[model samples]
Target: MTITTPNNSFNATLQDLIEYPANGINSTVLLKDNNSQYSLFCLAAGTNIDEHTSTRNAVITVIEGSGNLNLEGKDIALTPGVFIFMPANAPHAVQAKENLAFTLALSEHLPAKKGVSQKTIDIVKSTAPVIKQHGKTITTRMYEIMFDTHPEVKSQFDMAAQANGTQHAKLATAVYSYATHIDDLESLKAMVDKIAHRHVATHVLPEQYPIVGECLLKAIKDVLGDAATEEVMTAWAEAYQALAGVFINREQQIYQNAS
Candidate 1:
């Protein structure tokens, strides 16, 4: 198969580029860049690609084919027009029940800003004790401010939880945990994953992060008063953005896979 590097935009009919081998798969690299790649793949009937994992995220769009895609141990039927997304490192395999052709796109994962600075982590961690003590108060005030200013977001939350104070308690716990784990994020992986999934279920949009962050910072200042120094606020702001970036990226992947 030929691989070409284009210095300018190029277009072609994907179907015309397919080449099916009698007993194996054939592939052509259509385009490649610093962080992404696109390829076309064709497999003869009965051919298969063994289960494997990719370092980068990938999407497969069936152009003209019938197959079965085994993604993360779940089988999904593949036919013309079917699209599948696989997150980075998800185990997957493909078998061509009939002659199959598809386009594969791969993308590198862009992690949020190489993590918060050491000073930011130290500052945030130092405030963990105070955050733990006043966490619920700050989160409750945050929700009030947010609902008063952006009432549209109220629909995404559970009013019952809010009324009973469970929502505030949960946020407080999460914030305190985050502050304590600021330097060792891996310890908080389960919490992060759970929250990311919950965010997706609630259809949280990326744009709303800034609103929540602003309200949270203001609430902290209001509740902590003179204790919330400029340096502390700055560190928390940076830390919050870093945490938001992680959730945004994870939710985006979940959304793509659902689509």
Candidate 2:
């Protein structure tokens, strides 16, 4: 069963929602949204759920009865109050040693909060001309630094594009565009959507955003030297995080849709 409220909030007793079928299992979706799914499960004695894998991370809390959970080849006894966390794609199976009831919460990794201060927007916009002039150099240096420091991520990039300088040039243009439209982000919706799709296709993870941001900031400081003042660097860092937040959120939505 599903519950919908006008305010998008509700509270219900888990025991009231549970229904144990004789020699079978029952599941009720308590809530579901883009980021998460909350469900209540009831299993009759002798019931067994075959091993399986899930695309989203999950947590299980045993509310009543007894069971055994085999997670990634490890057997975990499940009794009242037992809680288990299962990472995405980990194989798991469940058997009811007695009539069992549990709560399963599945969720995707959420992106960091996103918002750029007005001061940061102004600073980034004011530096557009300078960034435009040295954008290519900074981006090229950024890729070099990133590859040198985080060699594991090298496979995600297109070596051919990097060798031909096309990738850096493209990033330079994107940087300039962002600076020009800092205050009018709606104008760059198409470009942002295109890049977000490309990032999802390339399997970019939210954790990698900080790595790229670090490398890009270092490259900016190296290329601009004294021109990259403390304030400027700080503003750019904030701007990059805000931009990364956008990409992370969009990519997450795409992943949720695909799943």
Candidate 3:
């Protein structure tokens, strides 16, 4: 639909935007800058785009299904994760073998940023099913362990909410949500920002993260018993710290703004 890049941080999962139209081909402009542009393209089976030339070097990244790229009279097969670097002024065309979808990146690409390790991402995704099934139980136990282990932190929570079990329920949902989205933190940016403001209001200190994190890991172990393997525990710990850093950094900014 409508595409506009506001002068703010932007984030999107490319796969989420891929959609074939009734017209056989659909394209969405994902991001645009003075020198860089990213677009997502979806094509129905047997669809073909006539050859076209770009003044800038464009990288074609196949995201789903199979396809072929005709680049300057040379044909190249396309598949999931395959990348073709087409030079500037080169004429190229795409022909979808099935319901193919791909991303087109144009610009001098910047170096990739570091994120949670692939192993951690895989572990989180694979373990999410099991954890979600027991999320409420684990979070319920987490608060008990936390308040008992450090009663001082209890006052930080709304006693009324805790009395009704809503506090535990919310945290439980958030915990599982974090696990599924650990690889795509940008998608959680708004939620993280809101939580950071709430944390700032409640005077949540950075040092308190370790206490909550420890109790959370222990709670998972206590609830799951033999099911919470060492590898699973390590992945959650890393994910928690990565998320904690997001909050801490945002809270610092909130504090700075207030002062």
CA RMSD, predictions in order: 16.7, 12.0, 19.8
Error of 2 at 50 (Å): 40
Which candidate leads in TM-score? Answer: 2
lDDT of 2 at 243: 82
lDDT of 3: 0.79
Ranking by lDDT: 1, 2, 3
Q: Write the per-residue lDDT of candidate 3 for residues 1-259, one digit (tens) a residue.
A: 5265647677777778778876578888877754477888899988998775554578888999998999999999988999899876477888988899998888642222246778888887787877789988888898889899789998888999888989788777777778888888888888788788889999996547767877898998898788778998888777766666677667767876886
Best by lDDT: 1
Pick by TM-score: 1 or 2, better one? 2
Off by over 4 Å in 3: 1-114
Q: Which ten residues in a row have the lowest lDDT in candidate 2?
A: 1-10
State the lDDT of candidate 2 residue by residue for 130-204, as single tens digits: 999999999999999999988999999899999999999989998889988977878989999999888989899
Residue-level error in angstroms, candidate 3, position 32: 42
**Candidate 1 TM-score over all chains jointly:** 0.58
Pairs that collide in candidate 1 are none
Q: What TM-score against the true fold does each predicted structure earn?
A: 0.58, 0.59, 0.55
